[model samples]
Target chain A: MEIREIIISLFYLIASFLFIFGIKRLSSPATARMGNIYSAIGMLIAVVATLLNKNIVSFEYILLGIVVGSAIGAYMALKVAMTDMPQMVGLLNGFGGGASAFVALSEFYQKIGPDVAPDIKAAVAISISLLIGSVTFTGSLIAFGKLQGIVTGKVVKFPLQNQLNILLILALITLIVLAVIYPQEQIYYLTIIGISLLVGVLLVLPIGGADMPVAISLLNSYSGMAAAATGFVIDNNMLIIAGSLVGASGIILTNIMCKAMNRSLMNVLLGGWDNTASSSAVSGGKDVVIKSVDSEEAASIFDAASSVIVVPGYGMAVAQAQHAVKELMDVLEKRGISVKFAVHPVAGRMPGHMNILLAESNVPYDKLYALEDINDDFKTTDVSLVIGANDVVNPAARSNPESPIYGMPILNVDYSRTVIVVKRSMAAGYAGIDNDLFGLDNTFMYFGDAKDAITKLNNELKNM
Target chain B: MSDLFFMVYVFVLAGFVGFELINKVPPTLHTPLMSGSNAISGITIVGALVASGALHATEHATLATVLGVFAVAFATINVVGGYLVTDRMLKMFKKKK
Candidate 1:
């Protein structure tokens, strides 16, 4: 091998190492910033080495692309509010998918039948990249829309939707077969791309807002697989390595998220559950007895409590109550009460959303525990303060055999001595099922906007 | 070994490494970890650069050039935006003083 070629391969290897090191740093809150820096540096090394490797005939276009791309990226990155993080993540995934699709399509355009032989392997790689990439591109856009409120959060379905999706997949497979057989047919390839885009929309449309975090993670996985296929299309070793890493991590995260909710990946994809149906079903059954309390009364209970567990959810995100809750935690801690935050895996609109929210509010990392880690602690807790969270703490998941959320792992807030829930109303959660916890004798609902209620309680505690 | 076989070797090894490294990321850091990986996956910008320049010699150069420009832009957005946003999120995570 040429010395230059060997050197370039070494750069790729070095870049991969940095990427791994960067990801490893994410294990702790303290080192995560440094991890981002390491991965960015790794990306820098890879990009620079590839540009300098003597393959480019023109640098002008590359330079222009980089300048324009960097400007827009930097601007958007700086402008995005922490609250809008999920949408930003969706948009980033979409861009990655688009790039992979374009890259693979360009290669196919440059190398099909007339000049290059109809290599079946190349054909397979190209089609797979295009398929996965286009789906991710559109699916992620829809997810972004949902998070951004440009699209309705409710599941959108039509007659025979699943059947139509099946037909689309069948057609896609047939086109792949045809493309492989007649590699020169550009029209067939384009048609496949179009169909894939439609399928992407169809696939994500039926999924309700409650399942969006799972959907986002799944699309993240798709984007990784798309990049991997592009790696095969371009015969780049680094692409495959990086792509598989993202793919594998995304899959693992997605599985973790699914297990958290006790829902299979297939169920999330098929999108059958909706809040309206579940809520209606819940209200239809036996009447639920709720014990409602004012924030002042709850504050008195909180003041007397020896220990408290604060569980925040998507409603907390909606009400932007993390900071208020942090204040409440501080007030409680100052009074010699132990305070901890319990986070469900799929708590917010995306994985780790609640953690980010809590962290952003300067909640101590040591005080935050995952569901299982803190579930047992709830049993002996003086007060389980549920901040705009439902379903996740529902005892029905543990007690009711017919409950929709029956098998899902939840924060055992019901076991606490006094369960004070801060919510807007007694409405069922996104699962639409009535929470059996509300009817429990020890459960008291403090109804109001989460931020206002928590702020009031904080003040009340201070006055006490 | 065949070229494909070598690529597979890299793939399998990297897959293990990625899984192990990522599993270490606490749930609090999952968003940032994902954002960081999103940037890493933008590694395809290398191919985009090469394709754009290489296509300058072909008859369908214009089409390839357009696609290349877009690929570069999108990948850049993924890389730059992703990394920056991740840093932004991570910066917000403070250990209580």
Candidate 2:
């Protein structure tokens, strides 16, 4: 190898080590920010090293693309609201996937000729890259649309939906085979791309908004796999190592999300809440008694309590109530009341979503506890203040086997001495099933928007 | 064949390292972890750079250049946007005095 090649390889090796160390630092909150910076630096080194490659003959296009892409990316990073993070991540995932697909397409175009074709291995790698990359690109975009309200969040189903998806997969496999056998044929490659794109849409369309976290996680994994496939086509070790790392991280996250909801990967992929009909029927048959409380009454209940645990959900996100909830925490703590937050694994649209929102509100990280760490604490707590959360804190998940969400782990807010639930109305949650926590004997429903309710409750607490 | 075998060895070992490192990340940092790793996956930008800048003496050279430019741009967005967003989120996590 030439001296330049050796230097570039050494830089890549250092970057890979930095990537590993950066992720290792993520195990603690204190060092996580620095960890992200470390990874960014590693990326910079890798990009610079690649630019030194002898094969690159020009610099104008690279410069233009970097400048334009960086400008748009910085704007998005600065302007997006914290509540819209899930969709933002999903959009970026799509971009990464799309780039991988383009790389494969470019390679294919460069290699194709009248009497020449790519090797069998290159052909196979290109096909896999195109297939996975297209699916991740379109699927992530669909997920983003659902979260951003550009598309309906409801499960979109059609006649023969499953059958059509099956047929598409079969056709995609056949096309992939044909493309590999006749690497010179562009028609087969294009057909495979088309089918894969359609399959991406179909794969995500049936998944309801609540299951978006899982879908996004899975798609994130696919994007990495696509990048790795591209690495194989290009025979680049840097891309392979980085891609596999991301692929593994995404898989672990997907599994964590699936386990949080007590569902299999296949179940989430096949479209969640399959028993909605029977479960809703079972929950709606009984008219349970519920007690309502105003902010004044709720404030008094909180005032008397010594400890409170706040449970936040997607509704809190919709109401943009994290700041207000933070204000409530301040008021409570000022009165010598200890306040902590209990976050269910599947509380919001994405994993760790609620924690980020809470963090944005300037709540201390140490005060937020995961479900397992604080689930039993509710039994001794004075007040469990549920903010715009329903299914996650619903008691049915524990006590009722007939409920659709029966097996899912939930925050045991119902066990608190006084359970205060703030919500807009008695509407069913994303699962379309009644939350029995609202009707529990110790529970007091505070009906209003989370921000408005929390603000009013804060006022009452302050005036007292 | 030996080169391919070596690549597979690197892939498998790197995957294991990724799994071990990521499993240690607390649940609170899961979002940042996702976005951070997502940024790393943008390493495919290396391929895009070569595709766009490498001089090709072929009938499809222009087409390859156009596609490569787009890939570079898109991958740049993924890397830049993902890392910055993750940093923004991670900055919010703080411990009380």
Q: Best by DockQ, which number?
A: 2
Model 2 has an lDDT value of 0.89
Candidate 1 local lDDT, A154-188, one digit each (tens) = 87878998889999999999999998898877887
Residue pairs of candidate 2 with colliding backbone atoms: none
User: Highest TM-score, which number?
Assistant: 2
- Write one digit per residue (lDDT tens) for candidate 2, span A1-464: 99999999999998888888888888899999998899999999999999999999999999888888899888998899999999998999898999999999999999998777878888988998999889989999999999999988888878988889889988988888999899999899888888888888888888888888888788888888888888898998878888898899889989998988888988887778864476447677777799999999999999899999999999999999999999999999999999999998888888888999999999999999999999989999999999888888878888888788888999999889999999999988888788888778999999999999999999999999
A-chain TM-score of every model: 0.96, 0.98
- Residue pair clashes in candidate 1: A278-A432, A279-A432
Looking at model 2 chain A, which ten-residue stretch has the lowest summed lDDT? A274-283
Q: Which stretch of 10 consecutive residues in model 1 chain A shows the poorest summed lDDT? A: A274-283
List candidate 2 segments past 4 Å from native.
A275-280
Per-candidate clashes come to: 2, 0
B1-97 per-residue lDDT for model 2 (tens digits): 6877788888889899989999899888888988888888888898999999999777789999999999999999999999999999999998996
The CA lDDT of each predicted structure is 0.85, 0.89
Cα-based lDDT at residue A298, candidate 1? 95
